[model samples]
Target chain A: MRRLSALALALVACGGGGGPTHVVSGVSPPVSAPPAAAPAPAPAPPPSEDASVEVGLGEARLCVRVGGHVHCRASDAHGERPLLEEPAVEGIDDAVSLSVGARHACAVLRDGGVACFGDNAHGQLGAGVGVASSPRALRVKNLASADRVVAGPLHSCARVGGGAVACWGENGEGQTGSSTHYAEAARELVVPTAVAGVSGAASLALSRSVTCALAGAGPVCWGRDTTQQPIQNTPPAAAPWLAGATALAGGGEAVCQATRDGTVACRGSGALVTSMGPVALPPMTSFGVGASHACGLLADRTVRCWGQNYSGQIGRPRSEIGTNVTVPSAVPGLPKIKALAVGGYGACALSLAGELFCWGSYPGAPREGGHEPSIVAIR
Target chain B: MRPTQIAAAVALALAALLDRGARACSCFGPRPALVSPGPDHPAPVTSRVRALVPIHRAAGATVVLRPPGGAPVAVATASRSMGGVDLVELTPSAPLAPDTRYEIALHSPGQYPSTFVFGTFRTGATRDVKAPRIDAIGVAGAHANPGAMSSMCQSADTVVTLDGISVSDPDRDGAEIALGVWIADAAGRVDTKKLPVYWAVPKNGHVQLGRTSICDPRELPLPNAPAVTLGVAAIDESGNTSPVKLVRVALPPARHP
Candidate 1:
């Protein structure tokens, strides 16, 4: 039983100002505990709560509404926080989102279209041309609307009706699909069309070119197949290194999938990751990808992340992994996190309470500093 | 319970709680902050700056640039007292002269506190010179059909020298030598001597590549096989030649079955 060191505990405590260190007492033993139940329905009117989601946007400010919109603000040398907000309109309708490249942000909309904003230098924004400053909605032309959208460092994707998937932006290593020629459009992948025969693609795991989809059975990924990170698509036959996956996320060079059996498997860049072992899963619900780390939202509405935190991506440390936290560490003091997003060097979580708490860089903002706000009740 | 036994029991209970807490807390979490190094001196230089920053702030902390054996040239200064964080860009009052040795001293309040960055970078000397000299010869590399490859280098026996003199500098309000390179076969020629590579999806989320998938390397995209050499070159503001670098990769030896 590895325990969080005193320094890690201090850092964690410093990260979140409110809340005493909790010691779970009577909770079911992790060995046989069932995944947490699905979260309750969100409240109306954007949950008069505090900001439940906060991220350290690159030279940008971040804010989120529990079951609502996610916003990022950045200035041009001048001190001004331009509002860049995108709202989620689906049941639990909050479009889980994350930042990519430098200033780009993408969100999954209720209508199944990916809404993107910020720098489009490499056309990474996906919201083709005519810059969208204030979340002006747009969709991929000639592409089916998606049920969810996952944003990578320089590329983005949306799961369409059926098991079909389309991606645009950078495709250096054919991570988007097996296409040989690069096309910057919502191009269809007719052959090997379905991601691992996924009858219903629910989410996308993107790492620049490589994209993995979470289906009913497990996770299936395509593009950029290396030895440590191979691409397999045989059906019925569960993929090696991928099974019981309910949610998936891609960060830096590694990809992590949440298994229904309450554990996680990650590969790429050869970094150590957390294993649930006999621990119970809270039901894989949502996940986000950062530059080199990933975070997931559980059915209980709590948040957990693994991988590097050189810039505080996984908040304050909890175990010996602080110097370079390789495995998943439970974020201290956060309660019932509704949705989550990961960016270059930071992560943000939207709490069911509608209070937006953030950990990592850009911690000077009075209200949105890295901690749960006791005063602001989200929903 | 004895004192030691009681203490041991407490420790065990705490460990159990910690384990449960660890798993319970493993559902989802937050991202980190933006801490990527912007433009800066190399890593070692940055480390030096961090170590020496505390002493420099005695007086208003500032960075003063001085040229080799010349009067102090106040190129850039720190507006605010930085806490040794790496500075992204130092907008000098004027661009430094090319091919000159310059010393950058980050002035903290105390004299010993300041750290000096020393380097000699040549500016646009090559720009003032004529375009890059290209020695294009008949098909010298792999070609199963010698006549075919030779035909590609038709007429022009002499290498074309794309002079940097004609390069334009848009920012300086005029043209600065922006010399590029390309190959021209007898049948066709490149419109511009520039690299065609574009942005692509990040491989592993870092290495920059074209956004699209890779196509057949042999299949040329241009309408005609515009003989393009390997890479391109650019000159600086000063008259410094940017090391006439060539991009024409040597073709593999041709094999005939």
Candidate 2:
């Protein structure tokens, strides 16, 4: 069985023109003056693309598992930017899976352990609130085994051994499967708490404050949806129209899933951002979601994206960057893909033969780091 | 517990204002008189915050609301950080009963303490459109004698304290006013920036002055200052403000002799 990868983002290939660096948040403006030899190709050798395992994108950074190790590069001055010099994450050796969030990142290890690093202000790092955030990754406590990990802006969750879903971090909207007072300190979860009532989960997706897990009981979701009435700390009703969800991905505005029947279903305020719910697209092998746009990998190895198109993330003409695409439009110029991810403001895909192609904000940010950012540099 | 007049908290506010005395006051009184619960006394109608903020950072204070003889309603409590004085929020498990008297109790520092009663939010509700006015400000510890209403009193060489400035919100008794205060020179110029904005809860319709004096001569080295005066203006949660009242300061008749 092929191990299907998930993380939908905008559609396209690298070098969609240097255009303009449009960062919604985190990526700071070029703080230092351009070095004497700035705006050239990457100073370091390009990543070994053939040996790559998986790729993860987030609010301000990117991560990839290569040669059984995890490496990441981030934007934001106080974020993981310092580690860009040596993108190999400071902790963990045998990382099996990788996931990134707004300002934090985490990976699942071969031994079924989990390590996270980045902002802890909302405890998204699992170090609890007020604990200083460091680039060094730290193991999440109380969990001896985890199958997969998913991280949202202010919180995160992991699939436990028995398929029991556990989550931590901010719970202002009770998004963590637990409730927290509105206070910052009260809302942070230093450790993961098992989300009751969810089991046998095959896929999960987390966004701003909404978390949806596709499990035996169907597609049940919880937390606060900016588009719906908040159902906190309680079992959120399953989306009636979203049964048999085989793959899941979410963005700031919505969550979409690829069902076993080969159709795609999406719901949330993003419907207003673009025409997202119950999209009539062809049978898809998998899909990835970015902040406000999403891309799907068709059985024939083509990519199509729709939704907020600012920065031309949906493969539309650069002139149509700010316009929204209601229809699933094809992302022109791409080879067959094995897996892909969406985050920050763009999308990237790993070709079947192991070549990497990214488009719409390639190598998202701290873009002015002397060397132009392109492929995920797996050292 | 009775609304005992223990002015220590005010002294702390005053001492804190002047970097002066420690808060020597402590009175565990009746539960909060349910006023509109915004971040810290704003408009009273948000469902998100069913809080009693009068506690004002009382250590380990817990607010519980219950129907008389009924089981305590579950509530979520937290200390809301409001720059000046952090306010505690108490979100009851459910909407409070209408026109009904619910008990508001402080579980900590127990004994003879009784829950407070807040029921005016009943009926169709007539909004208090009028901003409460300040009849006057009475000063204590300004020497044993005084002249006319506008006269500045004489004082001793060391400490001068203002118990609490009073306000009249006739629409409701026991009303609390968020007062903006500052020190001015006899010429009536006040450095609003260098002032302490405090709250005063009126009792018996009298100006229960609960703050410290702004006339700490050492702190106010105004060449034109011993004539340093006090400025008090009443502000309602609805962003209403009263005319500024300037009170002349009375320094000790004999200092640095």
Candidate 3:
């Protein structure tokens, strides 16, 4: 059987002729000098080809895939220079997928190679160095031809060739798939290590303390089980329910899987569902989970989300929509969504036309303004 | 034996076992060995005493310190658990007098009828003149790993580390001294937040403070700031404050490819 792949195309569009446009929204200015020479102008788009863009949310930065390159901006401090403009962020032209964690980000290149930047205190960058952090995209060691990459709060993992998974960074609760107790010593796993007992995996999903992979056998997860929640450190002996799951997604303390039958099974925080009860869900093609909320893209191209709606992450105010949406509700005022990405308290949807619309909150200052879906302009 | 007789015997045995368990007292610390003071053998003086006890059974326990010829000094207690060990720290409202003896007491209502004496320690000759020496101040990026992700959110500050700051005290044990830090950013904003300083027991002779990132509420936000200056001061047990020592750090310029 062909493996199910979360291969949604991210759209990118070049701006009209301009010198060097900088976009700032309560962020700080770039600390490094601008490039000595301007980059070559991007060619105009052909009528038949839509620009592809990939977006990832970090703790305080928003990364957008543009022209096969990834550019990032912060949402809190005041200044507006793209993080990719740094000299250290070279060889990002072939980035195919991007995953952003609390303080770092990783991009899967077209050749299935991986590179990461930002905080490396625990060596999340996978670079064999002692530096606490880096602005450059360091190539992940011993990892090549990765098809999918997911960045957890601290560690990062990638599904490499042969459906094998490799992980690095904090492994306190065995999140890195290493039995060694590193969290006790306050140490970190600096390089990607093969995840034991996991192969033929199609994709990986990470929460605060747990890592789950949709493998041939089923959705296998491991890591710290501090909450005694259904999402335990060890998979149940007999989990027929997980059979034939195509994709896995989670945030905060919850985990949800989309099955081939098009139904969704979620465990952890009950807030991810609606109060009306578990209604029959439409066949889903994609799924995204944030800290307290979850969203799914239907095969019909419509998007629906549930869980916490406090910040209007479900696309409406809590007054209009209740606090706990136990049932999946369609997100209003959105075009045909191609893909979706969820952050700590906010969610963003990429439209078929390559437009990005976000609701709730991203990294930065607290949510002070209205919580509504608004267009985010990217270059 | 009759069923009633057997049941009575089992109840008696269980009650005896619980009584023995309740009477077990496992407590230690206050460090430097609390003992009588002498001119040749002076005791280390501090306004606070930290005691290690069973965390689960310390709910109604109280600690008190009585100075010679003076009313009992007010003691505040705080409890914390680390590495499976629970610690209860007792801090006196005021420092003990120099060259004076103070009796320490622990009282648990149901566990002990009378106050349990923790022994007496005499304070040494006042050394309020010498303040703790600030050895060095070091800063590094916050530790980024999967475990730290739950609490931190994304922001422009993503590229910047939270700036973990470490300070060392040369005179007394690092934990014995109360240290306060002030951070000033390039924007000229000064934050005089009193950060917690933990003594490096295994490392010996060093104290560490601050988090991996400024996102922690206790840390001063220094995102994209080109430079920062930190001021540190040590407050002695006798309420003598040290002169502020300033350390200026020049951060790498923000990157723009």
DockQ of each: 0.02, 0.03, 0.02
Tens-digit lDDT string for candidate 3 (A293-318): 76666655577877777767677778
Query: Ten consecutive residues with minimal summed lDDT in candidate 1 chain B?
Result: B29-38
Candidate-wise lDDT, in order: 0.37, 0.50, 0.51
Span of 10 residues, lowest total lDDT, candidate 2 chain B: B147-156
Q: Which numbered prediction scores highest in lDDT against the true structure?
A: 3
TM-score quality measure for candidate 3:
0.52
- Deviating ranges (above 4 Å) for candidate 1: A1-70, A75-102, A107-113, A127-138, A181-199, A216-218, A228-238, A270-287, A296-302, A317-321, A362-379, B1-257
Winning model by TM-score:
2
Report model 2's TM-score to 2 decimal places.
Answer: 0.54
- Fraction of real interface contacts that model 2 preserves: 0.00
Highest DockQ against the true fold, candidate: 2
**CA-based DockQ, model 3:** 0.02
- Candidate 2 regions with alpha-carbon error over 4 angstroms: A1-52, A76-85, A186-189, A225-237, A271-277, A320-322, A362-379, B1-257
- Can you give the lDDT of residue A77 in candidate 3? 49
Docking class of 3: incorrect
Report the C-alpha lDDT of model 2 over A1-379, residue by residue, as the tens digit.
Answer: 1112212111111000011111111111111112355442122222232344566666666666665566666554343232224457878677766777666777767788788887776667775434557678888877777867776666788888747788877654566775322223222235687887887665677766667776667767777644445522343556554565556666664666665544566655554235545565665545667766777666556778776666556765546443577778887767666556666556666666665556554344334321111344343
